[model samples]
Target: MAFLELHNIHKSYFLGKEEFPVLNGIDLDFELGEFVSILGESGGGKSTLMNIIGGLDRNFEGEVRADGQLLDHKKEKQLDDYRRGTIGYIYQSYNLISHLNIVDNVLVSLNMTNLNNREKKDRAIELLKQVGLGDQLKKHPNQLSGGQKQRVAIARALASNPRVIIADEPTGALDSKNTAEVLEILEKIAAEGKLVITVTHSQDVANYGTRIVRLADGKIEDDTRLKPAYKTTVEQPNVKPKVLSAGASYKNAFQHLSYNFWRNSLIMLGTAIGLFAVLLFSGIGNGVNAFIQDQINSMINPNSITVMKNPAGKKMSTAKFEQSMSQFANDPSKLLLTDKEVNHLQNLKHVDKVEPGYQLSTYTLSYNSKNANGSGFQTWTKAYASDTVKTGHAPKANQIVLDKAQAATLTSTKKYKQLLGKKVKLTLPWIDKNNHPVQVTAELTVVGFTNGGQTGAITGTNYSTMRHLLSNAKADTQANFVSVNVNNSKNVKSVAKKITSIKDNGKYTFGAITVGDMLDTVNQYVSIASIVLAAIAGISLVVSALMIIVTMYMSVSERTKEIGILRALGERKKDIRRLFTAESVLIGLFSAALALVLAYAASLGLNHVLYSIVKFNMVQITPGNIIFTVVAAIAISFIAALLPARKASRLNPIDALSAD
Candidate 1:
């Protein structure tokens, strides 16, 4: 039994079903320590036979046995493994990857070995130095002469330490001196107990080997032994090969991206612009919502919910309850809450206290014969934040807190503080106990100023003080609204729900409104606006994805020959597909990183400008936004790369190796 055997190999090409046979029935036996040359003219079967031995051409009628193990051509994976572990190929063109340096080109094969990265690199350098291109390891293929290129190819082939080395016209493009050096290298390789096969048409080249087989028109014309085979010597252990892992594919993809970064950066910039827009708008929406909540929370107690009489007699949302406020204005009697409802609210769970108060729509403040019209005048309760009183104490008995504007209306804007200690006549029309309108008047001392929130300028007095004045005027002073203060801010919503659930005869009696409900209504509108703007910005991402798709297709077209070389190097279809997809995803990853930086920078600039007017940051990017940007970039790139990568993966190794 021989080290390798070929039995009756036959191969053909078809011109639209018209058969053109390339190889006839062939039988051969090869062993270690032999430099066998297959010499033939152009259009003969020398290269075709080499392809069969190298496992690149499997659609043939034959069986190949490597050390008596039948090579199964029917199993694609088996053939890939056979080529990866058992065979090394040297081509006349020295098909090195253009983007990779000489050492990197060799490492492409070493990456599949079980050796560690440091070990693989050390061996690659060792192999390059052995081939006498030690100083040229950093050089690309274009920097080298024809012979140097061939030497790099030889180093790459030997990197994986395959058992048999197949050279297809290895020295066809070299001068006589380079050819002699290459042949000597081959002779040394054979002496180390490895089978070396060279396909050549040169008679002199054939004569340098241990044995010569001449082929004329696909049939062996003669078999001649020039000299006895070299003595087989003890060889070092070969590197154990493994299937290409996903990590190596991504690493290679990263190298290629780095090699062409300037071009890829343009695509990344385009993608980053879109991501930045989305990130910025989302941040702005977040900040806007936060600012609104902050401002509202500063003026009103979030732990207190304002309960109003349910004029419509049903459970209502904050918005719906707000819509019914105008009807209460038409008939103020209906707005008054009964004593029973106010007492019920105080008994609810989480309720700290329930303060019942009256809200007067029309009123007049008279001081020093200066009169100003006022509205939204209500009795002070726990619902108003103490901070809302910008200056002075809360209104005491016979005292009223006038908002700055109303105080300014009665006096000069600069001297409104002077009116704080002065007495003012407050008069308003109110409903009697019989639902008939009557006039109410009081002399209340102005004690403080406020910056009213939600409702403009509010004038407030104590509940007992207002009740006393109304009773003196023979007018109804029933509480129109009640503030249900919760024990904890977190329980505000639950208390509001409980209040809204309080019913009479299957009809909700009171409508409740909390600070959170108002903030939510404002936030809902802000979110819709931001989302619409972000969607408009997303148009650019679609364009960016299209650019990536076009660029990947161009890469597949440009790297078609490289794809073929990788396939010939024993890479599987999925690995080849992964190469392109991985590169695209890296592009996306970098683009997202760029977008984060962009969004942050833009936020800083815009916030600086907005802070001057609003006294707060207007854009705030969150962790969720960062994650979304990164994920979006990767998903778009992966989707964009699918078709191009698939096309690259499906090319025939033999046909691809021949591509110009």
Candidate 2:
């Protein structure tokens, strides 16, 4: 059987609905070691016939049998294998990838092979030597001469040691000297027992072939045999090239993008800065919220629920108030929360402890031969009478614990120790039923000092002496409010609900907020800021994607001849598409890496500024965000490349060569 056979092949095209027949009833055959050349004028359908034979175009009607196996149009992988392993192609325009060196360009054909990198490199160098490009193995395509580039293309075609070498005007772009060099290489390839089929318009190239096929209007018009026979054979080596995984392939693509850093720098930088801005804003907002919550925690026990009077005024009028005494200022019968109410609250589920508290503000006291003003002070005379001294030694009738700021101010006056044990005479501004200043004197012992309170600015006073002084001189009100501490924080809300029910008439309402609630509010606020930031970052991401689209489209246009050359070499449309898409995905991944670096730097700067304002560190970086940024960038890249990839895959080898 003939090594290759085509029986009455027919092909056509659709031109605005009218069928244009390009090839009709064409028959051809070739044998091993035969150097054959096909020659025709432009638009005569010579390139189309080559494309069909090479399996790049399968839509045509044809019966192409190779080595006695009828080529099946339905099985794509079978055709792919045939293209990758059984056929090699040389082109008029060199089709080496600009991003790869000569050796890598050749080795790319063996990417799907099973050989390791060393073996693939060795085989690639051997092929390059055979094509007279041995000295240029380390050079890129753009660094080589036109003839040298064509030689590299020839070496790449022979990298896989295919059974056939298909040449489409392989010397079309070279000078006479380089053409002779390339023609000699083709003649040598055929002499190794392989089928050398070339399509050219030059009679000089045809003169080098052992047999010549002439075509006119897609028909074989003449066949001629030249002088000496060509003999050739290619030894299939035991070693082959190995294929890289998807991840590794993209990594290589990223490396290529990095190598061209200056070209894509602005896009990467812009995207990185945008992402950083978003993260920084979110972090600042979080830090502020955390600081506020901390202030609240230090002043009140997280497990304690404050029971205060819900004033008849606006709901928030008493919301942020200091402990007040009006909630208990009622006749025993009118009060929903009397001593009986306190006993009842102590019995509630999860109730660990309770303290009845009452207070009077803006009182003045004299002590230690010095007078200290208690403006804005809270006096708890009726609440926790003996328990206060039980917790800590009772504040002496002559002693007191000054809030740190208050003590500091008093000490700054150089009268602190003198005032600690001195008699601090009390003077209440409110008059009693007797319409005289309600006054009392107590010797206060300075026990300890406290600086922080609910607003992160309050001073503390021991409850005992303050309460004793209040009881000795009747205050405006008694202990009308209570503070309850629960053992289990989870039960605080439930217990508060039950207590509120007991005072159902709203005469004595109780309200409580948990630390967990504050934490949730802070987190929700931060999350909202994060989403807004992501949206802003998205704008930069979109710009990056557009950059990728523009770059890929330009690449496709500029590499049309390269894609055509690949198609002539038995590379399917899928291969062309994947190559373009791979390049785009690589660009996106590189940008994402750049974005991460910038984000980290920005976080450092942001933390410095935020800590100054809120006095706390707040940027929280998670692995999930890193992964999301990368995935989002890559997905955007892939989507952007779709149109360009499709354009490359749809190119016609004939049209492509004609453009040259």
Best by TM-score: 1
For residue 189, model 2's alpha carbon misses the true position, in angstroms, by 2.1
Q: Which stretches of candidate 1 lie over 4 Å from their true place?
A: 324-329, 360-375, 405-418, 423-430, 433-443, 452-459, 469-475
In model 1, pairs of residues that clash are none
**For residues 1-660, could you state the per-residue lDDT of candidate 2 as single tens digits?**
379899999999898999988898999988888899898898888888888777767787879888989998567656666777777877776766677788877766765567766877788898888777777777888899999998898888877777788888898899999999988988888888778899999898898989999988988989998955565346656633233345434544555566577876766666566555554455555555566566555544567776644443223322243223345333321222356656667888897787665434455555435455664454332222232221134244445555544554555545544444433345544333343446554445555444453343332344555556656677433344577777876887777666655554544354443455555665677678767776876787777677778888887887777676555545667767777788787666766787777777777777788778656666655576677777877788789989999999888765765554
RMSD of each: 2.4, 6.0
Best model number under lDDT: 1
Q: Which stretches of candidate 2 lie over 4 Å from their true place?
A: 17-20, 72-79, 227-234, 238-252, 293-300, 303-336, 348-351, 359-448, 460-481, 487-510, 522-539, 558-589, 605-615, 618-660
- TM-score of each model, in listed order: 0.94, 0.78
Report the C-alpha lDDT of model 1 over 387-429, residue by residue, as the tens digit: 8889887897999999888888899889999987889999899
Worst 10 residues of 2 by lDDT: 382-391
